[model samples]
Target: HTSYVLGCAFSPNGRRIITADLDNKARVWGAETGECQLIIGEHTHDVKCCCFSHDSKYILTSSWDHTARIWKATDGTLMNTLRHEAGVDSCAFSSNDKLIVTACHDKIVRIWDTERGQLKHTLAGHQHSVRSSSFSADGNRVISASYDRTARIWDANTGDM
Candidate 1:
């Protein structure tokens, strides 16, 4: 974990916790005893955001290193590393946890296949840095909010804005 903790999220069952820190790491913690569980130190810069998959089986994090990463929630094992042109500001897990959406300072929103670790779609329409992105309840769509004073909806499958 970094020197300054940036963001944190709790598992769906509330048994564990994950934190993103300026130390360029995300850490898994035992919620009950506040004991440090696992340390993910792959990011080369500050970690901006971190989140858990809906089912609490995975952890996702975005960082100033211009990347987002996924890890196994139970053991902190890295599953994937997603690269972007600019710092990754935020990320979201699809309803089924099979996909991820990453919003970055490059003003692009990228969708990814979790299992295969492949790029799915690049939803590029924002005129400024995208602050955050999310998968819709049904997981058929994605929404992004940007510093350009716009919130856009997109077709997750086709990358249509």
Candidate 2:
């Protein structure tokens, strides 16, 4: 990438790496050979974060283009796109890799069903842009930090504070 590399993560098994870039692309690389294996480039704006699922079979990415996407890790096939009302700042997969969480500039934290790519919950309460989010170890709760000067926790299944 000619521009900034915002984030990068190694796969759980340590054989591959994924990177998020300002060039509107996410790239998968072979860790051993250091070669670019695949370019997952569907986002129209800068990608802010990228991560591999706990089992290392899937990739999840967040973008300033107001979407989060999931892809097949082995071949870089696009699996799902989760749309948001504003730029997405971050995203993560649940412990079991069955759920996804995203933080957005719209002040909302969203929970998504990984299998159907459906919106499962909209965690609303932050007074400013949500900057980051992650699921609990059990995947039953979500924690988010916001520009609103607060960090909040919510029930991942219920979207409750």
Candidate 3:
């Protein structure tokens, strides 16, 4: 009841809820009882968004720290760190779970290889900050929305402009 919740996401199974907070923490709770099950707290800045991986085995968070992190949902272990030029606004995994896309305040979108934890490509064009991004239904492309008053489609595999 005292938690400063900022973003909330339901697990794929709907039994658990994950919340990201301005307090620089993320917590997992029971949806029915509001009982906290786990806490993730490695972020150095306020967490803006969080989500459970498709399999529910991992938690992904984007923050003002200019990075997005992936954690083991079961134990809160840090698994990966995805960096950006400016604050990270949001992130999402491809439908296949093999790639991740992050929208950043630097006005660019970046794709990462989930398994290797390496930056795959940067899609640049927006004149202002990129606010959000999502994978196409086929996972072959990404759509990015920006504060620049424009939206863009990018080749997910190549990061083409």
Candidate 4:
């Protein structure tokens, strides 16, 4: 159906596809047939990114509206809303699935507790907008790249340098 897709992610099992769009919506669909399934639409601005959780039951979306939202994959129910100081550029779930990290135009990187939707820590050092962020393979640290011409490493638990 020519979805206005901005980003797409496959479920862990590869059975479903989750997509985010500039239209401020995210949808879940059948991977093989491209059949539209669930649709999530609460974002006030363009959805820039989305990802399926490790278990494939949830979808995470980052938007220009300065927030990241978590949704139930099956029914598109809102699960959690994560806010940042500025527009969120990207988000990633930790490999262990316990934490979520978001990079924002506010020049900060933030870590959140996935289940509780609580702010775990904020990593601040970038002099310009943060472009991307990710958790280390060991899940003990986070790495962030910024337009500030630098990349930083922080303790995952404390967001310390």
| Root-mean-square deviation of Cα positions for candidate 1 versus the true structure, in angstroms | 1.3
Model 4 clash number: 0
Off by over 4 Å in 1: none
lDDT of 4 by residue, 68-148 (tens): 998888788899999887889889899878899999999999999999999999888899999889899888999999999
Candidate 2 per-residue C-alpha lDDT over 1-161 given as tens digits, one digit per residue, 9 for 90 to 100: 77899989999999999999999999999999999999999999999999999999899999999999999998889999999999999999999999999999999999999999999999999999999999999999999999999999999889999
Q: Ranking under lDDT, best-scoring first?
A: 2, 1, 4, 3
Which runs in model 4 stand beyond 4 Å of their true positions? 1-4
How much is the lDDT of residue 74 in candidate 2? 87
Model 3, position 128: C-alpha lDDT score? 97
TM-score of 3: 0.94
After superposition, the stretches of candidate 3 with alpha carbons farther than 4 Å from their true spots are: 1-4
Candidate 1: residue 58 lDDT (0-100): 86
Evaluate all candidate structures by whole-model CA lDDT and list the values in order: 0.91, 0.95, 0.88, 0.89
Worst 10 residues of 3 by lDDT: 1-10
TM-score of 1: 0.94
Q: What is the lDDT of residue 127 in candidate 1?
A: 97
Model 1, 1-161: lDDT tens per residue?
A: 42888889988889888899988989989899999998988889999999999988889999989999888987878888988999999998999998999999999999999888799998988999999999999999999999999999999989998
